[model samples]
Target: MASSTYKRYHVHGYDPRQHLEHYASDKPDMAFEEDVLKFPMENLAKTFSLGHIRGDVLIDFSASCMIHHLYAACEFFNHIIVLKVSERCIMELKKWLDMRTGAFNWGHTLKLHREIQGIGDELPDKEEKMRSAIPHVMICDLEKENMTDPIVLPPADCIISVWLLDNVCKDQDDYIRYLRKCSRLLKPGGHLILLGGLGMTYYTVGKDRFHVFTYDEAFARKALAGEGFVIDDCKVKKRTAMCDLVDYKASIFIVAHKEK
Candidate 1:
């Protein structure tokens, strides 16, 4: 029998609405936010507060049409450039940024971020800050040497990538190659904050199942070190919730700096 073609997937095959319903809900289960979102945001906040990561231009390589992970970075960077792999993703993000009807509600995410940073009273101001910081949302092709070709972006002080590498890369070598490509967009010694799911091979969206590269903490460290990054913080939160939609064993968060 011929192999199933349903396994074949593309970035555009991803359903933004289903993704939001699954992961960006206002009151996601405890494990969803606590393990997946809070830990990463807290680590980012701690890094910035200690003066380890700062930059005028912050480039978001994994613009997955969600801003939940952006609140922390917005507090530190004045300019945020979001690069998406697919036009569908870009359109989803634009809806939110432009305040179009039926945009995914991120109020819960904003509230959680404020609580994490102890800036509950400054939510409005911070929201405005993020709005002003994110002025550009463009397309990128990770397979290309210049991810954002024909449009040379200024070297960023820091780059944030969340749940991007695993899905795009077919194997470990591709993962490392893409990492190098993204690293090139940052200034020397610039910080790289990575958020990823561990031991994840596939995640379901609506009726489609997409591939995710399987990896672990040790492999992640090795990859970063090989890419000339100095690992500053590595945190792993074991998976505590099980949903039929996604199969991930743990959540890995890393903060590293490119060392030339």
Candidate 2:
């Protein structure tokens, strides 16, 4: 109900290891690799390769300590800025970026990305690329007027947010308002890439449960349109795995452009 509640869960209870092991594990049944990771990677690669999306600076709004979704974008953009809501999340990400002792190994995710791109033979160093591309990881509050306040980041060429809005917003209206706030971080005609869980109410991490705002594809389309974004592409994947750990019905990915 309150924003503090959401922050408490993530800042205190969120475990990067548990989050990665549960969702992005090498397990076959986990739809996260195919539905969440691979789909977005391929879409970004293809878009960037075909010259559909062009940008020098790319900003990720939901960095969440996961670099799998960012592998493709690094090839096209020179500068990448990752924004997180919780300090714990920022620390987890820095652990990896700094190559600390307990950093979560993302080799499996990088391997999958290389396979999808058909670059297994001549794979670029993904970890190094990610570390070099992402120079800043700062705190951001979606409800605020300037997400990266005081710092005053330049408007990004593209913004990416995955599974962030539903977890943070209290309802659909709140979600839409947050979406508009995120859009302000982008330049006019800049792209917005979003990945979210459809029809999900809550998810479990370790022993604690967190809330999610549920909505369908229809609602997503209308919300993006209302926020002055033109939907360039949208994809939805039905859930095949039935796990009590997470109760999402489907995964939705959208690529939208802010209207000039």
Candidate 3:
């Protein structure tokens, strides 16, 4: 994979609305969205519903402005904190929190989440529940000395980071380094639930292809174990359909607890 050809996620300014429509919108022809977004929501609903990994606070460390996965999360956690690298993402998130006009509708994703849990259709009041649980959306730098910058956040009971680190890290070493950084945010024995594409090189968004840090299941396990996390559960979703816009062999979801 030529790293030069792919754009860095932090360097490019993404249209948060465009991105949501591309992957999370309810379109019949969105094959890539069907695989990439829905798979994670299914895993999260199943995993969190097991009643083992949840707490008072959960932090979101995912790429793009997607919060559909967190719909299941708000049910378990008391407060949700969103950490984003882009100002555009922060603003878009706030729009949802405030319930402004034109905010990307997460209704379809919520429907999928409810479906995965075998619950009845229609989440009442849509995302008002999730929005109520989220108290803050702050700017974070994955590479900064303090990822949250200047403000050091209180250690969280759990952190749900999906599809963020893979795009932020340039290589395997960087991946491990970022894992350690994410681990620092959790209290001792706090869980870190992560999701990412496996063996993926790049995914296109509106003519621009963004880089994906390629790694396999074994490497991910080793990295987490090396960073003081003990694996509690792991789930993999093999690629369901073939597509050129998105490339990946599988998607990995892990639930691991930090061991001091």
lDDT of every model, 2 decimals? 0.80, 0.81, 0.85
Candidate 2 residue pairs in backbone clash = none
lDDT of 3: 0.85
Worst 10 residues of 2 by lDDT: 1-10
lDDT leaderboard ranking: 3, 2, 1
Backbone collision count in every prediction? 0, 0, 0
After superposition, candidate 1 runs with Cα above 4 Å error: 1-12, 27-31
* Stretches of candidate 2 exceeding 4 Å from the true structure: 1-13, 27-31
Error of 3 at 106 (Å): 1.4
Clash pairs (backbone) in predicted model 1: none
Candidate 1 lDDT tens digits, 77-156: 88999998878888888888887998888887787887888876676776667878998999887767787889999999
- Count clashing residue pairs in model 2: 0
Which residues of candidate 3, in runs, are more than 4 Å off? none
Give candidate 1's error at residue 57 in angstroms. Answer: 0.8
Best by TM-score: 3
Instruction: Name every residue pair that clashes in candidate 3.
Output: none
Given candidate 3, what's the lDDT at residue 66? 87
Candidate 2 lDDT, tens digit per residue, 1-260?
34235333343548867777777777676656766677677776776677767678898877356788888888888899998888888888888999999888888888877887888857657789889999899988665688777789988899889888877877788889889988888899999998888988777677767778889999999999999999988988888666787688888889999999
